[model samples]
Target: MKDTKDSWQDSWFDTCAALLTDPQNLRVWSVIVSLFGDLAQRPGDRLSGGALSRIIMPAGIKPEAIRVALHRLRKDGWIDSARQGRASAHFLTDYGRAQSAEVSPRIYTRAAAAPEAWHLLIAEDGAGQTALDDLLLAEEYFSIARNVALGAGPVPEDIDDDLLVFDASARTVPAWVRLRACPPELSEAAHGLLRDLSQADALLPRTPEAISPLQIATLRMLIVHRWRRVVLRQPDLPAAFFPADWPGPACRAAVFDLLDRLPRPALAELEAE
Candidate 1:
């Protein structure tokens, strides 16, 4: 940060961060989650406050914001901090690690997870509401209507309600259904990320080696953070299940392409600089 004015003029990191950081909507706590999940999810991995600031400050987050976020995360049992002599180091708690691990596959996978076996669950109009709500937590279930849920894989055996199940395949899904499957707001986020990915990709150094490890970490955090929001919210279904214009496939491709170019750096490399 000492030479930030000069670095801004010369570094690709600033321009890419500018393009990727949602200033109006930037959530420091979420950004920290993305950072820790990407670089320090391992049990013993930690990021010292000094290194944390170096990586995040370039994204325009103030140190006070990060401090408040760290405090909130600690209070919520998501992170633990300890004194490391003159500086402090922070790492995820077991609960935090579990949460991050839960979503790692969806966040990191290069290929989409589309399954062929489809099933349907139906509930009595007003009586089985609780069962349906619980089932929605699993990735396989998608609420197609008030009383119905379409899912992948075998039907569950544990529900207590008088629920009906159907093993079905869709020969034809209507446009309205597809639109309902992925609403307009989700579509806009996907397209926005794709556009930013292209912009950030263009801003990077011509050769991968030219970028420092911290710079790589900064950009990767932004890419993965934005992507996590989009991918985790969209329904887990086949590409054909969504609208023909859905940007899911294209955005996924662009994300992995840029992330592959900026391969994740080691915690040691990131902290050292």
Candidate 2:
């Protein structure tokens, strides 16, 4: 009986070690997730800062590490923080908690969608072919890509109603975009933007460009986001994810508008680049 118990203990320890070592698991993120899980299952609605720290402390992370991790998580929209006295009380966003609940075998798998508006798709060279660095880069890119697609401050006004499409096929990428509406004179604008995006210095640093490595990463994640949205919106969408939006063809129109807005050279360059 003593030998059997010892063997069980050893196995348990090994399993834990494996879980901690796996990069896909995002150990710090898991800590946040587990913390939220506990809160979710709690009899009360929220957790106190001290209670959260106590729960996280046993995981072998230091106080400073926890603080930094929490900050990053909140900044990235994974969690929310509320000032409660001297401590920042942390709570998981629906997105973060959903991400945390995924286990090893299911880490990259998509989850059921929560409430959200708009969807984006990214077509990468290979699916599920990325390292931890790539994953982190992709996360950052998605944030920026979201802004670019919606015509944020850093990007030019030309993309106001356009979707910024980044093609990552060569040394310098191009952001081929298409707009929702077009004036007859601007028919060639898509081709022009594509050309500009293909140029080496098309995008200035910290501004939306066609070839930013960050944009490449964003494309990868947006695909995941799009896939999730499709699944979520399917029930309400009648013609499937690709046949275009239901009732008339507004969804299809929007997609084509985006395509039309893409620079002519950029459109051709996608297959070649």
Candidate 3:
């Protein structure tokens, strides 16, 4: 088993990466996840806003950012908080736990703290795992996948898209992957995992192993599922998060350019599969 400290650090790192990539409420969500994740390891597995402020605010974030994030997290069912004496104590919800499990199988690798909750990772077949991975990759490559499916439409719209008639078919591919029947709490956890993966890219031990094309396809599928959450949450999110006069106009632009350049069957074709 990995060291407990290492695991904790990895969890927080994942939360950060997800916050940065969040299509909406990026900063707000980051603080909330950071606070709750930290509390998850505390003495009573809980902490108060004042305690959290001492930890997150010193990092130079504004107080408003922390408050907004925490409020939204609570509203969205990712966490629960109450007055513990003079301080506000916070704890993860079952939904948060399930979503966390989705991000890293390691979170669910051992027995659960609650016996009623099932771990989806423990339930997936190898193909299901690959499919989930591919969904994520597909979301990352949405523009490309769309163009490859049916020419070009709009630029990559901040991870949201038109109600693709094909999304239904794509969902079926990962149907075998039995996610723990939980609420949107898992959504927050998924964001947490994304944050960690993005930030800890450098620290994670680089495996020089050769990955198969099938694995890449599976990853793409996972990306799709990951981004689909944003789509479901915000049907009409904005685009062009990049600032004006940004030195690299082509950075995000290049993603769409490549999207239009892909050779595979369009997203429609994948759905037809």
Candidate 4:
């Protein structure tokens, strides 16, 4: 009976892990980042090599992949490693923690639709277009066209004055604008995540305490990793900007619901097991 129960649990965990893993791509380094962010964000918190392998290997990631990813991250200065006797331990570098902190709110918070206040920036055909392009990558601005961008907040005197600015709000939304805000591929990603989260929810135990801490840690990492890919790519806009069928809100709720059920475990607990 004990062996039968263990087999059942293993099957259940693998199924949930497979459902939550990204279908399109699985970047090992990025997954490590999510795992660290979810589990080891504090300055002194570190995961021993054995613990890291135990949590991540269940997601079908190979031992060699984790090694390569750790090497790459250490080379890029996002992670620092130390020798603990014959074992190794790793922690995020200052630079890496800052990068992770910047996006933590978006990944962890249950956000509502953005405020309605908006403004438009129109640029000269050539050089101005190049200038506006930077805002797309740097700020909350969304690109309407090669030469036009939509943003919020007070107009800045710092940018080129040659560009035109208009403080505006959506009186009417066109199909093209909706499509631009939530393109077909993004819409598909959101829908897929929603479906996967629902499946994971059904598979997990009703009482969170029933699962082992390492299992919970593994499951949380997969959930957060997959959700990060969808949410970070999405622009934070008012509901009117998205397609009528956009599932961003639903996905966000499901992500949080599952996370709440499986509260984050202490690093020591995960490592000891």
- Candidate No. with top TM-score: 4
Each model's lDDT comes to 0.86, 0.36, 0.38, 0.89
* Model 2: colliding residue pairs: 177-262, 178-258, 178-261, 190-262, 190-263, 191-263, 191-264
The candidate with the higher lDDT, 1 or 4, is 4
Q: List candidate 4 segments past 4 Å from native.
A: none
RMSD of each: 2.6, 22.2, 20.3, 1.3
How close is every model to the real structure, measured as TM-score?
Answer: 0.93, 0.29, 0.33, 0.96
Compose the digit string of candidate 2's lDDT tens values, residues 122-177.
Answer: 33334322332243243322221323321112332332132434432223222232
Candidate 1's C-alpha lDDT?
Answer: 0.86
Task: Put the candidates in TM-score order, highest first.
Answer: 4, 1, 3, 2
Question: What's the lDDT for residue 27 in model 2?
Answer: 51
Question: Which clashing pairs does model 1 show?
Answer: none
- Candidate 1 residue-wise lDDT, 1-273, digit = tens: 659745753566778888887634889999999999999999999999998998899889999999999999999999999999999999999999999999999888888887888888888878787678777875557888888888877766775457788888878888878887889888888889999999888887777777889988888898889999898888787666698889998999999999889888988897687
Question: What's the TM for model 2?
Answer: 0.29
Please provide, for model 3 over 2-95, each residue's C-alpha lDDT reduced to its tens digit, 9 standing for 90 to 100. 6885675445434433333434344646445533432252233565565455445433456788788778888888877889787677767788
Worst 10 residues of 4 by lDDT: 152-161
User: Could you tell me the TM-score of candidate 1?
Assistant: 0.93
**TM-score: which is higher, 1 or 2?**
1
lDDT (C-alpha) at residue 97 in model 2: 60
Output the worst ten-in-a-row residue range by lDDT, candidate 2.
236-245
- Between 3 and 4, whose lDDT is larger? 4
